[model samples]
Target: MSINFHEVKKKREEFWNSSLVYKAIHDRLVKQGYHLIGTIGAVKRCHWTKEAVVRKRFCYKCLWYGIESHRCIQMTPVAAWCWNRCLHCWRIQPEDVGMHWDDTRPPVIDDPEVLVEESIRVHREIMAGYKGNPSADQLMVEEALKPKHAAISLTGEPLLYPRLSELIEEYHKRGLTTFLVTHGTRPDVLKSLVKEPSQLYISIESWDKESYEYFNRPLVPRAWELFQETLELIPSFKSPTVFRFTIVKGYNDNEKALESFSRFVEKAQPTYIEVKAYMFLGGSRGRLEHSNMPSHDDIRNVGRILSEKTGYKLLSESIPSRIVLLSRIDKPIRHGKGCPDGVEHPEKYAPAFSKEYEELTD
Candidate 1:
């Protein structure tokens, strides 16, 4: 029997459009100043976006990781969808309850070109509110209006968006840098990308299947295997790739998982290894206690373990975000205004980005 994709989409839209639970989700997001994309996509101002607007502090990605958050537009192409309901996620929504799309995927999707245009336009509209404020930094506003960076990670799994490659191309054509983060559930989507982002991040919240279930609460089966597929493909990408570990205390943070974690990190040999602490915030608060939040020193200790196991040398850190950066010895951090051309650009020049970080010697 053949599947009716059209019917599948229609049913999904009906569920989202007519449900009050989802209505509440949309209402809350809109009130938070999130601009809707198509019927389901979304773009929102990052708290760092506000800081950059008012010229206070930039996001940790900028201060430590090199991307200028002040000139960044944080968004999600498939904002209302995700595969896992991780306990640490800040965006707690009714739409995220499922592991896959309604039946399969959204019935209606905004064109990649149009969504790109709308994303920038919507972001601009949100920024309009800060224009007349007395405290707003006009210089920052001017630079921000002409966004040079895009963090496609505000909420949801960006890979779920069809034409995601085209979306990246559109941003690149307009001279905007792209940073895409995925939960690693869609390795097939990752493999098919025609145009890679300036920076690609695959989040690894767990090292084993048991830890994955306990910490991630994936809505679908074989979630761990799916994540592994993405992990194995990371080394082959044309652009700079990263494996991000969002560690929650007493979940996947113990030494028991460290050896498995080391084995996985060897696959991508990412340019940077981010050992980030999970914060107790938003919907996560309802599911986990504040005690679950890890301290900076805790993350540091874990970073050291990863460093010791993988040979990546510890680099810089942002204490506020409670994250540490580990660099592959020979890779020498390469960053620039736009794409880090081979070195500055994150294209798939395998020779340069070659292998896991292994500089430390004990």
Candidate 2:
């Protein structure tokens, strides 16, 4: 019998882990406690993960709305994959986003079950380091050990993962609240999801197609069409939906872009809108200069413009993270399912305080 060495070699090279370039990245990620899932995904510890345990402070989300930061896991089902090589992105885009993963011919696509199992294990392992820290709070540590929330956005385009719904279900089954962030590139995938995330976020890079293409550098031919489709479906979803904007100064920060953004916001009619500054970090540092990183004041000024254009009340601001929250006056704080600490449910409004941390960073 003749062995097919070609197939074996192909399988081995699929991981890209052996390549010197990828190896360096993998090593650094592992050092920071990132757990690789199958061939193209990863789960990493959130800064809030450690802060929640140490009693320092929760993520702006916890401070804004109310989720136990320690009880949340940060993961991405597709880490080494994305359709847009966004200039402001902080994570490494494994490939120059082309038509789609199928068209891109990714090396590996792991089972959802394995991804979940390994994700939990790696998250726990990362937290294990905090056990010995003097500032660790025993109560919060135990809570952290038993996570109740999952943010499926460590990096990459999660919806690109074929089995993301299953992954979301897995987390939901485990009693964990889930959030799914998409770049509004694949409304077809979003439409098919039966188990929508507890909160759904569509990251809007720019309002105008020209700026959108410039900022996102998408691989697909009609990327703007996909975004428009996503906006159309926003109000139809029973689940709370949000539009997140990562404002990069001198690029998507001009008055024209903001005006266009307001038009898109009106069309989306999302439950909430988060305006955030684009930080200069990760592979983005190569594409954009530090001058591109907008200041908190810069972000606030744009937020003020958006509030005027959309009539979405300015809910709150996080000076440190360079972000602002806006909500429809009717649903601002009194109806997020519960306030100060609550998970939003579909059509089911809770409590009278609504402020969700709009995490736009990787």
Candidate 3:
């Protein structure tokens, strides 16, 4: 007799939805601005998106890579599943509420196409609030309704979602660019992707395995080995790869840490590196001190040191976001298809990139 996988998945979904823990957790998440999409997917409005719509201030991603902030849908497939409980992460933790669930995955999965469709619907509903506000830009607000990009890194481990490649493909089919960020623990999933995102990011805040365990607080064993495996696999990707470091003051910014990070950077040789300061917000405020959030100058200092060691050029900096972008090439890779009006005149919007880094760095 053949076992029915769909039946098993349906039963699992029923069990998850009927549990008291799920009800409690779901209620809290709903109140916290996370709109659940399908069975396990979620979409939340980014603060930067609001800034872009109301104040004409874009995020570091927009300033660096031409991603329109207001027109980006920030969604995640596995909203409640993550292998690591990084103290710096702003998302609420299950342990905080005296609850625990499987960190590796959800009880059941949703179809990639359904999740994508529902995500856009929910994103538009969330963005609708701006239309009534007098301060919101009507033109940008209208553009936001038709999202051009999907940021699949909101609050969970995206690689854990089994059908992530299909999800990326679905978004691409709808003429949207996808940006996937992972913790670099799932090499098998990364290697098996039938369709890759427009850009991929591996977040690294720790230098060594010991620091990885301490900082990331990974739930699984041999996480360091898994991370190393993913790093080695980065060079094989066709899409642009990025190493994002969320630098917390007095922790991963020391000289010894930079040296260890340099060794890994040499091995991966990613196209770009983002040195970003950790923001003290949400649940992270409970775990770390206020001083742990580094200033813009501190980010640049660490970024310069890492650039020198890794031979990557310091390309640009976004002071408002407290982040810096470093790249192997001189110019940024711009995507005009997803951008509004099929053009992203970066120089017109981002005046900071006007001067050459040779003069700025010197």
Clash pairs detected, candidate 3: none
Q: Tell me the tens digit of each residue's lDDT in model 2 across 145-256.
A: 7777778887778878888888898888877788789997889889999888888888987767787788888878888888899889898887778888888888888888
Where model 2 places Cα greater than 4 Å from the true spot, the runs are 1-28, 31-33, 94-105, 329-362
Best-performing candidate as measured by TM-score: 3
Quote the positional error of residue 229 for candidate 2 in Å: 1.3
Location of the lowest summed lDDT over 10 successive residues in candidate 1:
353-362
- Candidate 3, residues 1-362: lDDT per residue as tens digits? 24344664465457447987887667767777787776777898887788778767677677767788888999999877888999898666777557876667667677788778878887888778899799999898999999989999998899989999999999999999999999988999999999999999999898888898898999899888999999999999989899998899999999989898888889998989999889877568778997898887899999999999999998877765677888887766865322332123433343343322111121
Tens-digit lDDT track for model 1 on 102-199?
42245456567666776787777777778778888877677667777778888777887878998899899998888899998988899899999988
Residue 131's lDDT within candidate 1 is 77
Candidate numbers, best lDDT first, in rank order: 3, 1, 2
Report lDDT per candidate. 0.71, 0.71, 0.81
TM-score of each: 0.83, 0.83, 0.89
Q: State each model's C-alpha RMSD to the native.
A: 9.0, 7.0, 6.2
Q: Residue 21 error for model 2, in Å?
A: 6.8
How far off is residue 245 in model 2, in Å?
0.8
